[model samples]
Target: MARFFTLEQAQQLVPEVRRMLNEAVEARAELEESQQEIAECMRKAHQMGGVDLDTGRLVLLRKRVDELGKKLKEILDQFEELGIQVKDLNIGLVDFPTKYRGEEVLICYQLNETGVGYWHGLDEGFRGRKRIDRDFLDHHEGDLVH
Candidate 1:
């Protein structure tokens, strides 16, 4: 079943969720960098007549890339287990799904924010966020995700 979160519940989860997100984001960057380094190493070897290759260095790079990729995937799985939507790893955007005004909507938060303060309709995304306020809270209903 899909998990739902209330504004208060989502806000309360900021600290832990942010930490997880940061770790995932860092791992993601490292994984990308690792891939680039491996590619560059191979390119350099091929360019140099495919001889005098640094096999040891290339092997280490590949291993590091695999490790970083595994770490990234683990972090992503943690997010899935938590049931929060990871919208953008680059920007650290996440969405908390909950009911407002008898309709499902999303409460949005970005990496640098202290707390979630915005929400938007299901069809409207980040660009459509509106500030969370009394009206929004008053209209909120449904079971909150743990």
Candidate 2:
């Protein structure tokens, strides 16, 4: 039998998942900044014949870049650990696919909110997101691994 979740329960789970995704976004931003810095350093090094008094600085920059890369990986792993797969971010919502009730459900989470109160069928659009009800939730509860 499939177990269903109440709106309150689903709402409760959204906060932690959202937090994990936000952390991943922050990590990605940091990684991009680190990459830009590394590229700039390399550009400068090339301009200086690949060996200059700033060689030591270049080495440090490379190390920082590597660190940022590792951090990004770690963040991504953490996000996955939390069962979040961010597929898109537009306006203020982050869209992703998640399992619910033995089926793949498209969930859209508001970045500024705590709960994922909106979702839709696999082939449905935004308007397809029906209000979560007891019967629907019950049909899919057994599918919730988390």
Candidate 3:
């Protein structure tokens, strides 16, 4: 069975999760920059003539891209190991799967946001985010639990 988080547990993770999201967001941005640099190198090489297999700069760019990829993968693996679903890398959006009213839903968190305040059905993605009840979050009384 997939890991599930209770409302209390999810709320408790807000601060740490926020930190993790920030790191992931930064890493993803760096990875993207490396990829763009590599693409530009490829474009320049192709524009000049047939590709040069022994080009130093191109080789360096490729190496940087590989390093960035590994870094991003490590961050993602950390998230998975924490049972957080990576919904959107661009926004550093993630979902914590949990049960509510006997059904599964996700507690959504995005890098730009503070605290987990939204949720959506198993079928609903970020676009379907619904504001969580402040009452439920604050007290956790009578709120759904896993």
Candidate 4:
């Protein structure tokens, strides 16, 4: 079941989520770097007729790529377990599920934002985000009593 969070509840988790998201982003970047390096190596090998390829370095790069991929997956899994939606890893965008006026919506947060102050409908996404206001506060629902 999807876990719904009130604005306050989502705000409370920002710090921890930010840390994990940053870690995940770094891991993803490293993974991409490794993959690019491997591709370059393969390209070189193909062009040189595989005559001077360093198999050992290629193996090590592949291993590092695997490790970094696993690390990124673990971080993403943590977000899943917590019911947080990772929208954009490169920019550290996420959404906390909630219901506004009896309809499902998202409490959106981006890296370095002051707090959870924006929200949008499921289909609206980031582009349609609206700033939290009194109407939103009076209508949103979550699992928490407050």
What TM-scores do the predictions have? 0.92, 0.62, 0.82, 0.96
RMSD of each: 1.8, 4.8, 3.5, 2.0
- Per lDDT, the best of the predicted structures is 4
lDDT string for model 2 (1-146, tens) is: 22233344556667766666676667567767767877787888788887644667767767876876787677666655545555543323444455566676766566776566677776775667766566655654422443
Q: Say which prediction, candidate 1 or candidate 3, comes out ahead on lDDT.
A: 1
Cα lDDT, all candidates: 0.86, 0.61, 0.76, 0.93
Q: What lDDT tens digits, residue by residue, belong to model 3 across residues 116-142?
A: 888888887888888887643553222
Taking the tens digit of each residue's C-alpha lDDT, what string does model 1 give over 1-146? Answer: 67888788899989988998899889888888878887887888889988857889889888988898888888888878877889999999999888888788888999999999999998899999999989998998646544
Candidate 3: worst 10 consecutive residues by lDDT? 137-146
Pairs that collide in candidate 3 are none
The collision pairs in model 1 are none
Which candidate number has the best TM-score?
Answer: 4
* Residue pairs in clash, model 4: none
Q: Select the stronger candidate by lDDT from 1 and 2.
A: 1
Q: Model 4 over residues 13-73: C-alpha lDDT tens digits? A: 9999989988998998999899999999999999999987999999999999989988999
- True lDDT of residue 64, candidate 3: 76
Cα lDDT of model 2 overall?
Answer: 0.61
